[model samples]
Target: MAALTVLALAVVAFFAYQANAAPDRPGAGGKPDPTPVEEIVPDKPSETDGADDENPALPPDSGDGVRVVYSLSAQRLWLVAEAPDGLGEEVLHTYPAHRSTVDPEPGAYQVTRRDEAIPGSDGVPIQHVVVFHSDDEGIVFGFSAAVDGSLPDPSAQARTGGIRQSPEDSPQLWEFAEVGTPVIVVP
Candidate 1:
């Protein structure tokens, strides 16, 4: 009886910690933080709708709402979310990545699974894996960061589905892309 009580308390504490650690998003399984985020307005607005050469804009065709956008051709990904005030969308972060040989067709998908750490198809230790799609051939497509800070060498191994990001960027992507979160891929 005492063991059961202690286990119940431990479970409650774990949930409480997770709720606080979760991102403050509508679909991220946590209550949105009531604090308003400060928006940094540029002194000189860009010529277009907030997009500039330095910070590439998301493809106009990408559907709205909070989503992780992946561009196959550019080998880049962006984490976008609705502005706190509900005015417009904001790009929280973007970074370049190394993709594997097999690519998922351009479209929308959702994060189906996540692993804190795992061995990638290339046998490299990886972390913060957020899997969104899998091909009919049994290849699982996901975003992850190599534990050793090295990208996959296409010529060194068989086709893999791990899209490798920098160690710094993987955690942010993992936090933003909870299961059921949308992932949009564009050409």
Candidate 2:
């Protein structure tokens, strides 16, 4: 019985030693692995070749609310309105923006409830509770009904003048007169 006990202790000690042995690769699970530094990192350029020079000029009908224009071939959000002459169009505002990550399918506009926290100039908290998108820029521009009543006569000037960026930090226009409705964009 003493001899059997001694053999059992020897087997346990051998297994423990084997279990505690260092792996061939450091910081790995008992396996040989190549150094991380030896792995190649892929290179990605933001702009594609000839993307800029190939950009088409803004179309004649490109007047804004939520128009999508290309900057150096990168898609940009544009806010435009009719020119004062009652003849042509003019660009009002532009912003660089990232499209919605989850549902960015083209040509579909949906008004959804959003409750994002934003910081005010005085460090107060503001929330963006409403968001809308339209395939037509005009529709997006028309949704700013909250600001239409506060402007002076000759409302187009008011729409064009003193325009401020959206509190939501979005490229989309936040305020405008009712006359400035119907955001139009060229394809």
Candidate 3:
């Protein structure tokens, strides 16, 4: 009887923590809206909107050139396209990504490979997988999304490495980010 009471209290505490930890979004488990409505990931470079202009994702000194900036803290992805003159750059698009509890170290990385529909670590059929960061063992963290746009929410104890995105946004990433493209993860 005492153990059951303790477990019930723990569950209540966990729910309270989740309500505070995650920023409220309409599609996220029915939480209250935390920010204004905007396009988190644009379709193209020229067609991008100014929804993410104020909150830049790339860190200063991240350098110029064609690269993708991913912020782990902000859960945002910004595609950068450099100017032909080699002096200026522009943000192609911005996206809100869902990452696993296992985070990759913030550093420069290059895309190593690409593949089609496959079973991700979370046991979901994922497509548009652009492999970038992998540990010495077998963990690989890359850009991918479930074939049906369903997201897998794992607990902290689970060491998942797949970076989930939307079905609508996955194609954009697949078309824009080719093999060997630069990817910089920021805090």
Candidate with top TM-score is 1
Model 1 stretches with alpha carbons more than 4 Å out: 1-49
For each candidate, what is the lDDT? 0.82, 0.34, 0.75
Candidate 2, residues 1-187: lDDT per residue as tens digits?
A: 9999999999999988766674643544654332231131212222654123233234444444434332322344454455557675444444433222122223323343233343321223433323443223222211211121221122332221111223432313333212223333223
- Which residue pairs show collisions in model 2? 64-80, 137-183, 138-182, 138-183
Better of 1 and 3 by TM-score: 1
Better of 1 and 2 by TM-score: 1
State TM-scores per candidate.
0.73, 0.31, 0.67
Model 3 clash tally, residue pairs? 0
- Candidate 1: residue 122 lDDT (0-100): 90
By summed lDDT, the worst window of 10 consecutive residues in model 3 runs over 32-41
**Which lDDT value does model 3 have at 152?**
61
Clashes of 1: 0
RMSD of 1: 11.2
User: Alpha carbon lDDT of residue 102, candidate 1?
Assistant: 78
Task: Evaluate model 3: give its TM-score.
Answer: 0.67
Off by over 4 Å in 2: 1-73, 108-130, 133-172, 177-187
Who is ahead in lDDT, 1 or 3? 1
